[model samples]
Target: MTDKLPGLHMRIPPQPITERSTPRPVQRPENAGAAFQEILKSKLETSTLKFSGHAQARLRLRNIQLDAEQLDKLEEAVDKAAAKGSRDTLVVMDGNAFVVSVRNRTVITVVDRASAKENVFTQIDSAVLTD
Candidate 1:
């Protein structure tokens, strides 16, 4: 003898899932580029010059010292180089030589009196002899 059981449903149909749409690119204002350029120019005009890390290290290694007067002269020399549109410049003051990047306003290297005497400077477009 066989026993009969109630009907049970086991198989179900698979359902499809919806996907999200791709995002569009953001749009900028028409004058955005001009405005950004103006802001950059203003910031550059107000920023003070600086010395690069390598320059500082060279100064320390050579035991070179710069008095207040010498500092002022170096600033003036950088300004002069910038006025001439020089990107790389050599600034000479009181037997010391400094390699400056005018656009970035940074002193890239230092040559003490002894090194300056024998070294031939290159890769610089202009030279400034500071008082």
Candidate 2:
């Protein structure tokens, strides 16, 4: 005879794993740098010069070490940018939310907002993402 249980089912639904929630797109390690460089070059060439047919602005990402959580955000941003076919993509790590530049590989336009100091991170474009 089978024992009776009020709320027991033969099968149980699987719970989502917290670790697997992070976005990790399959990328070839060798292709990452090349893709990033190509994107950067295209952006520089197509964008109109601010004055005298010359561009005087260049964005640079600061070197800051990132933890697991921050790294996840970066992965998400890079994934979105790559998927969008953006030749000039910008990956913004603002607080918890991540912002991406379509295809540009530069950290442009930083306001230094007081609220943006949620976390210190090493900002990396796709060039650094794959590696």
Candidate 3:
């Protein structure tokens, strides 16, 4: 060590700067549009539509009967509801009422013509009427 004056300080070395590498591309599901179209088409073509447990019970209790034509109308209503980004929808067909889940293509509840007279639908984002 060399002799130095009082209150002297030592210098430190600097760190090297490194370039960052490029990030990898993000992964996502393929054929989203095709999948949506396929599901919609399948639902439209089916002879019958699916109902949730609560809806089934309500149908039995309310004596609501849906013929093939009525089911087709319901499917069409659901297709339109899905198109408009409706998650929960109220579909009215021939005086009957249905609460549908658009994303899952399911009818969550049902109200017959008689019950529908005084029914007030809630928690639905959209309503479609099939005359």
Candidate 4:
């Protein structure tokens, strides 16, 4: 300690700037939907992380029933296209898919309907888009 002025004193600490190396990790709420959207966007831009999943019966069945028949306000994309004199415009797609839902105003986790990789592909592939 050294006296600099009449009522002031200074003390030197023993730490140097170069010695500090590690950085603190940041924590954030897990937004699965946002994450998935980002992933899809990236996948669309770049052909990366492409893999097939096994079919799950429930997911397949759900796909078939999801927009199979839209009675009024809701219009089935595939069905509508097919009915509206669409030949090449009508796209039929069948792919196994994994359904995941996350609960949270600030998402923390994703609840997956398809447990495994194979199941995802299978379910999505089994889901008939048009035929």
Q: Write the per-residue lDDT of candidate 2 for residues 17-108, one digit (tens) a residue.
A: 77657789887788899999889766654543121111112122332345677655555555556655654443446422232343443333
lDDT of 1 by residue, 1-131 (tens): 75555685466899899998999989999999999978976775666668899999999999998888788788788877876788999999988999988888889999998887769989999999977
User: How does each model score on TM-score?
Assistant: 0.64, 0.27, 0.68, 0.16
For model 3, the stretches where C-alpha displacement exceeds 4 angstroms are: 1-17, 24-48
Residue 82 displacement in candidate 2 (angstroms): 0.9
Lowest lDDT 10-mer window, candidate 1?
Answer: 2-11
- How do all the candidates rank in terms of lDDT, highest first? 1, 3, 2, 4
Instruction: Give all candidates' CA lDDT scores.
Output: 0.86, 0.45, 0.85, 0.32
Query: Which stretches of model 2 miss by more than 4 angstroms?
Result: 1-64, 95-131
- What are the per-residue Cα lDDT tens digits for candidate 3 across 1-131? 88887887877889899999999997867988799989977765563457999999998898788888788789889888877899999998887889998888889999887777767899999999888
Model 4: per-residue lDDT, tens digit, 1-131?
Answer: 95468765666889756766699887766897799978965543332211123323443444433343321111233223333433222123333222211110111111233433343232111221432
Cα lDDT of candidate 3 equals: 0.85
Instruction: List ranges where model 4 is wrong by over 4 Å.
Output: 1-3, 20-35, 38-131
Best-performing candidate as measured by lDDT: 1
Measured over all alpha carbons after superposition, the RMSD of each candidate to the real structure, in angstroms, is 9.7, 18.1, 7.1, 17.1
Q: Which prediction has the highest TM-score against the true structure? A: 3
